[model samples]
Target: MDLHVSRDFLRGGRSLLPRQWFEPMLLAVTAGALTAGGLSWLIGAHDVADLCWILGTVIAVVPSAIWVLSALRHGHAGVDLIAILALGGTLAVREYLAGALIAVMLASGRTLEAAAQRRASHDIRALLEHAPRSARLRKGDRIREVPLSEVAIGDSVVVGPGEIIPVDGRVTGPPALLDESVLTGESQQVERAEGERVRSGVVNAGGAFEVQATATEKDSTYAEIVRLARHVSAGSAPVVRLADRYAAWFLPLSVATAGLAWAASGSAVRAVAVLVVATPCPLLLAAPVAIVSGLSRASRYGVVISGGGALESLGHVRTLLLDKTDTLTCGRPRVLDVIAAPGQEPAEILRLAASLDQLSPHVLARALVDAAHARGLDLSMPSNVTKEPGLGVAGTVANQHLTVGRHNHGSPSPAWACAADNRAMLDSAAVVWLTVDGHLAGAVLLRDPLRKDAPRTLRRLRSAGIRRLVMLTGDREEPAREIATVLGIDDVHSNLTPADKVAAVHNESAGAVTVMVGDGVNDAPALAAADVGVAMGARGSTASSEAADIVLTTDRVDRLADAVTIAVRSRRIAAQSALSGMFMSLAAMAAALLGLLPPAPGALLQEASTS
Candidate 1:
């Protein structure tokens, strides 16, 4: 077992090395070096200290040398070139103790990096491992446990109340309240009746129901999220050191400075001291440290920034874009209007429509059922039921030939259901047709409810200095325009394909950073194409969330403003920290050149003052 662990460590040390081991080692090395130097000095063992320096220099220089050579051979501009050059030069000049101190600190920094990655990877892994395994399958006269992939469409799967629905299917039982916050971005429990489509991963709240599988396990919603989280996490680039960018020139520049100092001072030691003091640790590490610090702060607020770079860029965004469905609105259709026929009681029409509509699997149908339930109205059992596609519904209720849906504009109206394309009128109303004894009764209009915070969030962003707000949607023009008017969006582009949405994000976007927000399959591409994509209802779509730079765990658009606010704060903090480090480093560099301090004291000032 020990051998296996050692082999694993050797094989995957760069990616898999755990922090508990290395972090302690760094502390031990740092403590040991400081103690050893003090003990040698107390014994007045200058030769011993010199000998210790010799051994440490050779030991440290070998690895740093090898790392530099390998980095160049592989055509890599090493991430820590400035630190490496400064440390290597210090050791070569017999300043072994300074080299040891810097080395231990750099090692600790690596441990910090490893710890941060572990936290993020752990979150992703936890989500993947906790996904449900088996689904309840109903067979002839008995329910059986079966592999999820083996279940086919139209096969009844019994999902117990409070269990995660294993796959997408049409409900074949009584009305159920489903918590689809993870599937959609809303906090409310959704109502679903028989024949209504129920997405996988939604928890059945109170009533257990039989759902005919419409999609398999591999094609399920959770699976898609797992896929997206993995895809969107492509490695992010942390800010590279400015010193490294100048290292080629800085090296030549440092060499010239040292030569000029020595020629003016007539001492090579002062020249070496100049090289030792120009390490650039503060310039290289301060921004990354500040970024990580900001990320840490964000995590406390329940926000997960993918990395430092995302936090940096998100801080500077000037434009905000939103998708209408699920992002700005509740995304659930609810019964809104009841246009009853002459002398037809509104209560009677709704009760009748809700009963039969409960047996149909449609978005609008579920809303109608919920509205009736809210009014304490009950529907009678439907008889001679015949649900014609797109014509709405027709059946014998209380021995009356009742029909529900749009008016038939042509042909014979099923002598019952039947729409001839004329039923599609009233484009604004979410309407459902009703028929009584083959007679057209009336239509019930249904519309999606608006989110309470959307208006305030939109208004606040403009006050928050957002230069423009654009709304892009895959939905039709009329509803989109209506939504735009309600939200007070500055720009609206409706009826766009996923490709079109991506293209639209590209248009009028050049230098200014744009943030796109959405929560659905259609919004995935646009999310990826934007400067920063914010996914709403992230618990629902792993792909969209993963594709987005930011993921909101709760299905609320208010988090959009919160995320922007947090990012801006983080970026401001990073800039301040970085510039402060630069100012200090520059002052120390100036002092070293003026012979104000020797090499050892200069390195100490750099590390101690910066920390």
Candidate 2:
């Protein structure tokens, strides 16, 4: 739990304001009245004891009556009706201490509900915080910084190194090295030549360059994603609590039965007995207790369920929609394996390739360097290093010439290198070719590896009653399908924008409870749109985490299965407690109708059963 939430829980599960402190204050007053009344009766002041008990009961009844009336005015009736009737009926019969006990139980229930509902508002600001606020506008030979709104379509914008692209545009002068991972979920830098289109929100990974804007800032891709997120969040329906749903029907049944008891016996006392016995304490108390237990258990397993409502819904999830990038894969490129040609060694090829790649700033270059370091290989410094913009890097290392990059398409590659390329394509991995002394030596294959526990997690979800598994991603068809195939996913939607992901979620959620799990800014809208959004929050973007109903706080994907298990078990326990309590209440109500039980003793019996 967050430190602020922990403080709120300790303070009667609500704010410290007087208005919000009603339930806890009422509980304290009720306890004081019970203690004072007992002492007064023991000292032969029976009248004084009755007054104390009456005062406590009235103080508690007034607010509960008002709340009941307010709920009725909203066209809803809840279990609070039973508590109000029990308090009033006990007071009418002068059973003061019994009324005081009812007040204590009612106040306790309200406090628990208030505490369980303590949560911060959904954070929409995370989506807009990263938006480009300013752009470098190039006006006919003079470049100046301006608000993003001032850069109109057809204007020239200068994107500096490490700066985010501010608008959708086409590169103008030279090839630009851009990282488009935010847009496409591809972990490699792309070289965009003159006349090639580029989307907004990508970072310039190389030297500064100019682009001809084809869209204004508001009309760009990032802005559209922000707009979609806002739309989905606004349109999402509020969760109806499980206790409230049961209260809707249970309230009417108890009221009608009590009315019948009064008519049949022609005595107000009989009706009071019926009302006392029918107070739904189990729904009020046991349900919230079970949900809180589930939330705590989930936290122990590295999942943070937002509230009782989300926890209850998790028990009923059937279809799970997954995002491809960080949800199922490692989200970064890594060296998978190396292929060596005749008379060449794999270790020697990787060492030369990594050594030559040390000075490059590309994402794939870093992957090679990390791979070499992982193997504890000592690298030689390259003297005379040079890059061929869109091709590869070349240098001299320890008296040998080395070149590392993609094989030139215009030139013939060795048969062995060609064979390696074919294998890399089938595996959806990138191939980096290394040439030593003017001959092709080897190839290094790189890929975003699937999470080690992903397979086991899927099986556990099936055991926990997930009926369908689908994947949605901004990645291309080949890579997305490959992952889905490996994981045995039933459906795959590839190359999706934020809007497309939201549409997919809506489609999946039409007649079933759907869970969308993701870990990127691009998933924020869909996270808000799904029936239950689960964010991989340990390394996920803040936007997606804020929009989700449940968050896995650890990097372990298997903990999600544990969350579902806890939800299902908690709900079962709550239902069992409620049903058994209701059965006992029915028997007590029958006894009261026959005049075998009275109001005060019946209230005690009901309280004991629920407790």
Could you tell me the C-alpha RMSD of candidate 2 in Å? 13.8
Q: TM-scores of all models?
A: 0.70, 0.62
lDDT of 1 by residue, 66-85 (tens): 44555466444543454565
Name the best candidate (by lDDT). Answer: 2
Query: Worst 10-residue stretch by lDDT in candidate 1?
Result: 1-10
**lDDT (0-100) at residue 592 of candidate 2?**
86
Candidate 1: how large is its RMSD? 8.7
Give one clash count per candidate, in the order shown: 10, 0
lDDT of 2 by residue, 244-343 (tens): 5666666677788788888998887788888777776644456555666676566556566666667778888999999876678875578889999999
The local distance difference test score of each candidate is 0.63, 0.74
Model 2, residue 533: C-alpha shift (Å) = 1.2
Model 1 residue 58 CA deviation in Å: 4.8
lDDT of 1 at 590: 68
